[model samples]
Target: MTFDRQDLSNETLLHLYQHLLRPRLIEEKMLILLRQGKVSKWFSGIGQEAISVGSTLALEADEYILPLHRNLGVFTGREVPLGRLFAQWQGKRTGFTKGRDRSFHFGTNEHHIVGMISHLGPQLAVAGGIALADLLDKKPKVTLTYSGDGGASEGDFHEALNVAAVWQLPVIFMIENNGYGLSTPSNEQFRFKSFVDKGPAYGMEAVQVDGNNVLEVYTTVKRLAEDLRENPRPVLVEALTFRMRGHEEASGTKYVPQSLMEEWAAKDPVENYEKWLLAEGILTETARHSIRETIKAAIEAGLQEADAVPMPTADIQEEIADMYQPFEAPVTDAPAGSAAPDKRFIDAISEGLKQSMERYPDLVLMGQDIADYGGVFKITEGFVAAFGKSRVRNTPLCESAIVGIGLGLSIKKKKSMVEMQFADFVTCGFNQIVNNLAKSHYRWGQNADVVIRMPTGAGSAAGPFHSQSNEAWFTHVPGLKVVYPSNPHDAKGLLCAAFEDPNPVLYFEHKMLYRSMSGPVPAAYYTTPIGQAALAAEGDELSIITYGMGVRWALEVCQDLGVSADVLDLRTLLPWDQEAVRRTVEKNGRVLILHEDTMTGGIGGEIAAWIGENCFEHLDAPVRRVASLDTAIPFAPPLEAAFLPQQRLREQVQALRNY
Candidate 1:
């Protein structure tokens, strides 16, 4: 397709040509390096440079772009330092992720780039979130996120588009139809004629452009982005591009037909754009050679600098330090006198969320039925009226997308709290929570300051789907804080602490205890240190380490049996108080670890192992654990009672104390 320049300046046209050429040259050099075994792997954007370059150049400098692995032009167009980009690809300490992530998997806030996770569609939802922040902040900013034709089939694609359309978020969902998702052709990916056809289902406007035409892609995105900034709505732009090379350097193009390759090769973005530039008298052979030489020189310099940098060392302390952003709880004096009104566990959580929303203007609450219906547990009751619909959002039943949006908000330095409704349903959003949110901070130094409120535990007779004590799931993942509070005071304080934290926190609230548990909760805002365990009851005979509903069970069992036990409420499972646990284990020679989760993979096993390893000499008896049976939570009250450690816990404590 021949193109009008859209009155683009000569300098602007030249700039576009340089960007298109830069990535092509970089890919060539990287391919040589890959052949020489210098770089491990490379996902070449050799023929599809126009889509990334044009789309990136079209956005405002501050506008965020979530690029895919093949969008090398996006980085070059953004002018990210070649030295750092090469260092990242070379696995050097000077890279953006400090050698933790490979290729374009890392993001830099300085460049307004949110990196892509290998999971393709989640980033689209995150883009919705970034756009949401801009909308809330009243900034004329737009977010452009890329997806392949293969990614278009993901459930996240539909969820993200629907959410963006419904909320009128200023986002551009760019589908780069590159014909294959790792050898699977677009024909097998989706039945729809084009991604643009799917837009109407979400009430979104979509357009298709010649992805290989630099001017066409640039003009199309520029118009859409300008419109979005003023109008603040989502638009779908499908760029018809083809992957010229294999998925990566190691993957040969044997799967791709030679005829198909020839067709796309004729329309190579770099070659076509260069031809157009020369034909338009916008560039000459001399200028083209000079630009190539300059880019080549820059690439060599970057490679030299990256080669000189050392690889990440095996320092365990440094590795641990980089896992999470250090957070210090702000100190606040306890309220004088014990005259505070007693509040239910649910009410305590409500108050904490309300207070946090008031304190952090950028704080947003998202969940199903949260705004008008106050959430399933009514934790956000009357929140919409008090904080407005903008802050208290009612999300669709898209757990994965909602969780991803929360991460996006955090990327923009905004705080977000997502309510899972039921902890068991977290599996739907597990990838976003575990992969994106959990690894974000450690991988890219991007603090995912998100709190996912998990209404957990059994005894409500809500069956397996609604009732689960799944804190152990997040506790096992690094870069996440797992907090399971037992009582009203701890719930409120811990929720506040999680809100103030700089990392992703899974705050598990026991559903059974929501109404059944109550305690004097201070009206004043305060934070409970996350990693500190509370000595709920002090005794010398035995140490009972527990959390959530297990705390109450242990306390009640000890009180009923008149057993002098040290009841330690490990509110934070991820960074549970090791020192406090050791002290209690030493003071009381017997140890019993308890939790509401099933026995086999429950967190109790980890606690028991830690005790055996660290407090073995202090133990008077073998470390014992009391947990639910290793079976799905039963519906019948009798079976559930048996499944939980209610009667068995009492028996285990008595048995351990005697031993």
Candidate 2:
């Protein structure tokens, strides 16, 4: 272990040189294709090849990794075919992920690489989750993650590190400190002496190394990998490297001065590794030339293969295109079971959670103040008493970690229910939700049976952050199922339905109505169908399409204003109530979509357009919408009154009256 270059064997030297050259040649070939307009675009990992290749070699076969956009070296090492990589760049059928994922954001089910995401910081939490699973299952595996120094600034990066450190998870966070993050230099991004130093604050081991020296990276990671395999815990390693090319294919060297480029060029990892191999008598001139020739041939062959692969068929595209597949709603004559008496919305959620927990023993619920505190809304009250701490547990005030752990548990095939203390604090775990849990099933096809309970919506003067309706954000994503329940019956039914669904569901329970709202629920244990809509009224004049609390508001307005408005409550957003909407528009001949969300690009507008396109002849009047103004939810009572659509405003019946 003494500091001596002589300690390295010729075989080790040759391997390092070969690894460095692999990515370099790939980068060169990618750029050539880019110039020829054969490949769409690429983010060159030309200079940072050693960092990816060496860091990846450090990982065990069964271990996990969350690579960034620039880590093609890792993909190559993982045995992802060069043809698939080329196909991805060319946006062809042969591409991994069927050309849906980015060129660098590749995944392989057989290889166990979960895939890359464009979002910067969320991978930290996802990696932590994988490591958490290893800890829980007593699996001898580590999750190695690579994020740039710029990505280090993301709240998720800090949050993930803190969670993993506290839990002593088997995660190795490798920061590829390439001096600059796109245009911003390290001096501007951070004040720390080194990114590695941040690890100690989170109660984890830290190390920094010459990222250019593939040997240094390999040695550091190899030791850490062994440690993780034995006694799994968190470790942070910062590799000082450089980006030889522009940030992306669209960018150019105009941003970087020639002098600075020339300075870093002198220490090229590919060239330096080659020199090191020659000095160690590992790789001679002939072998080096042969390796280069081999890589060149492989890349050319891959491109040719990629060019030949058939594009995905339009039929296949049409089949999976719609993420939100509305359930074929069953005929709703009263069930053969007796209806349960009225119960509080809160009570219904608690009952459903309890029943769900009892049914699925593996399902665990964790969040702050959830144990004795029973959650801020008391929805999870008495859960700890029944299931104990391991299953029904209280957590630290780290939202990221809470969701991260839930994700890990879900991937391990344990159903998980993670509640944000309040919908407001979900911003703390936004990265985990938006990037990891939401896309887990779509990206990896690893069924993430997780439900995120978010108490959201306005009217209780909880101010802008706490009372905001934020379902629009989750609805935009393809894989997630967003649900909002307006009453106890729907809440219980939808909550139960969420637990039964294979995809991750965002179960948003409006806190304002939780204790107040009560309705008739069936006594029997059953799961309400997801993606189905409940028709509140039969009307011919107009269709008031709504969901969540909007359903209640619309019903009230319809009764008060004497408007023949047919109201529908969509219990799910991803697989929305498309048929219900279609039937209502067909019957009513007029559509007036409504929601509490902002008017711009809200679900209401989407539904309106769908009806307009499909049921154009059914219209008696122009389709209208009543929604919150396109502004942030206000804090003051008066301003908030103006911002949110009042029931009085919706009561006008003008959209129908005008018809």
Most accurate candidate by TM-score = 1
Worst 10 residues of 1 by lDDT: 331-340
Q: Rate the local accuracy (lDDT) of all candidates.
A: 0.89, 0.77
Model 2, 225-323: lDDT tens per residue? 998889878899998888887788787667777898898898787787777667757778899889889888988898888889876665665436433
Cα lDDT tens digits, model 1, 371-391, are 888887888889988999999
Q: Give the top-scoring candidate (lDDT).
A: 1
As a whole number from 0 to 100, the lDDT of residue 267 in candidate 1 is: 89
Q: List the residue pairs that clash in candidate 2.
A: 324-574
TM-score: model 1 vs. ground truth = 0.98
